[model samples]
Target: MSSDNPTPTPGGPTRRPSLDETGELPRFLDSATSDEPIGNVKPEGDLAGRRFPLTTGFSALVRNRHALSTLIRRDLAVKYQATVMGYFWSLLEPLGMAFIYFFVFGIVMGANDKDVVPGSDASFVLYIVSGVFVWQWFSAAVTQAANSLGGQSALITVMKVPREVFPISVVFARFAEYLAGFPIIIIIAATFGHGVFGWNLLWILPAILLQAMTLVGIGFMLAAGNVLVRDIQRFLPLVMRMLFYGSAILFTMDRVSDSGLGQKLPWVTYLYEHNPLVVLFQMHRAVWIPGLAPDQVGIMSATFFAVIMMFLGRWVFYKLEPRVLKAL
Candidate 1:
């Protein structure tokens, strides 16, 4: 008598047993296939079809907060591993730059605190050091975040996590380093007789929030764009260098107005006033030098741009993610 199960000949396709004989569908038939749709089963490559609401990216970030913290820790650990004077290097580089700028502008060119930031009692050293510390974070975050996705292609492709985590982690890591240097800033301020305790210190919170928003927005765009076009990673350094000088790191907007450049070239000062970096720098410096506090117009402009860049960055990142994954 023939058995119910069909035996296949060597090198031949086995016939699927009938449901009556097996009492159930074959394993292959029971499983969903690419050609057939199943109830509530999302299609392959469905990311393209999903609606990208304004909160989608932020919601993903919120859901993946633990993952973000892990990434931030890993990045910090990798950055400091196998290095002597690890975190101190972050303080040293900016401190060194502050010294160089102080020498060139304060001594060589004879620019004084009164001349650079008029009406501010803070010494020139305090002014430059404060600006340098913050600028270091800004520069490092932008540079690292731009290349964050490209450098970690292996992790990004293998891990099923939000790609934004990489760039945002870099921003937080650099911000941590920035915060680490605060004691030094405080020491400098105290030494110069510019008391750090004042109502003006309240401004630091909003200043930091605005900057974080700006950097996150910029990071999203740069990280996604770099994956698509590798040239972005190369071109960013040049742009950053230009931004350093134009950002009023070595001087202040007050000095610019005092020099009458705004009158001679109204557009030049207008651009200077509107540049987010300049506005951000002013906000940060205003904490120590209250005279440098930005007017209502500057604050409003910066706030508007920060909001726009954030939403715009998320939109671009979402639009490009599909192509980015393929390119990766």
Candidate 2:
């Protein structure tokens, strides 16, 4: 007579576990489910390929905060471990960019003669350096986050940790770099030509928070999209370059707003004012110089945009996360 039952593998069943059970119930269910019930059962074989919702993604991140923090520290340490200058390179990079932009634009192009900040004592050098410092933080965070997933394939494939942690870690690590360079900016602002300090420096709190939110949103979208289309990785640098020039990094938004181009096309003013980076740069400069404040309307608009992008990007990341892992 034929055997009634097929033999199991040496240790267990031959078939793989359901992705829902493998991914969700055991880890996310125990604590988070106490408040919000999770009805996700072991998904059937056909349905197991689908992605989890945003709730699951957020829960995973919250549960893994310690691991996430460790990853951020490890990423930062590994980046500069063997280097001579080490963390000092972070300060030098933006400082060097400030000098180059100051020479080429402020000195050679005579931008120094024009007053970007009306009635403020700050000079072109101060303006460029302040903007460059913040821009470097934003660019480096988003770029590193975009590559975070692809770069940590070994970890992601083997570890039970949340994938979102990888991109979020990149954002935090780059923010650390920004924090490292901040004191230098303060000294430069105090000592350099016409740069001044005032109570407005408190505005930096909101600016950093808003910019961090914007970067996290960008990180989510790019990290997931890069997995599906590797071409996104190749094209990202070009996109960053376009954003750099378009965002008025070297000059002030007032220059754009008051320019002939801005006069002819009112949309140019609308566009720059609505941009998160423009709003951020304005806030940074306001903090560094007295008698300057970011446009209230622009700040409001950018904050709203940042919130939308944050939710939308998280949705996209969680939606495609399964496909991303499968492709890898």
Strongest candidate by lDDT: 1
Clash number for each model = 0, 0
For 1-328, candidate 1 gives per-residue lDDT tens digits of 1234575757888765544455442322222211222223222463433222222457777876776787787787778877998888888999999999999988898878776455657788887898899999999999999889888865554344467878899999999999999899888887873745688888799899999999999999999999888899889999999999888888766667656777788788877887777888878877887877888888998999889888888888878876776676
Question: Model 2 clash pairs?
Answer: none
Q: In model 1, where is the ten-residue run with the lowest total lDDT?
A: 28-37
TM match of model 2 to true structure: 0.81
lDDT of 2 by residue, 1-328 (tens): 1122234568877554432234323333223223333234222354343332223667778877876876787788788989999999999989999899989988787786346666666777778887898899889988888888888774554445667888889988988988898888777777764665557878898888888888898999999999888998899999999989887788776677789989999997888777767777788777776544667787887789789888888988878876787665
User: lDDT of candidate 1?
Assistant: 0.77
Per-candidate TM vs. native?
0.81, 0.81
**Alpha-carbon lDDT of model 2:** 0.75
Error of 2 at 184 (Å): 0.8
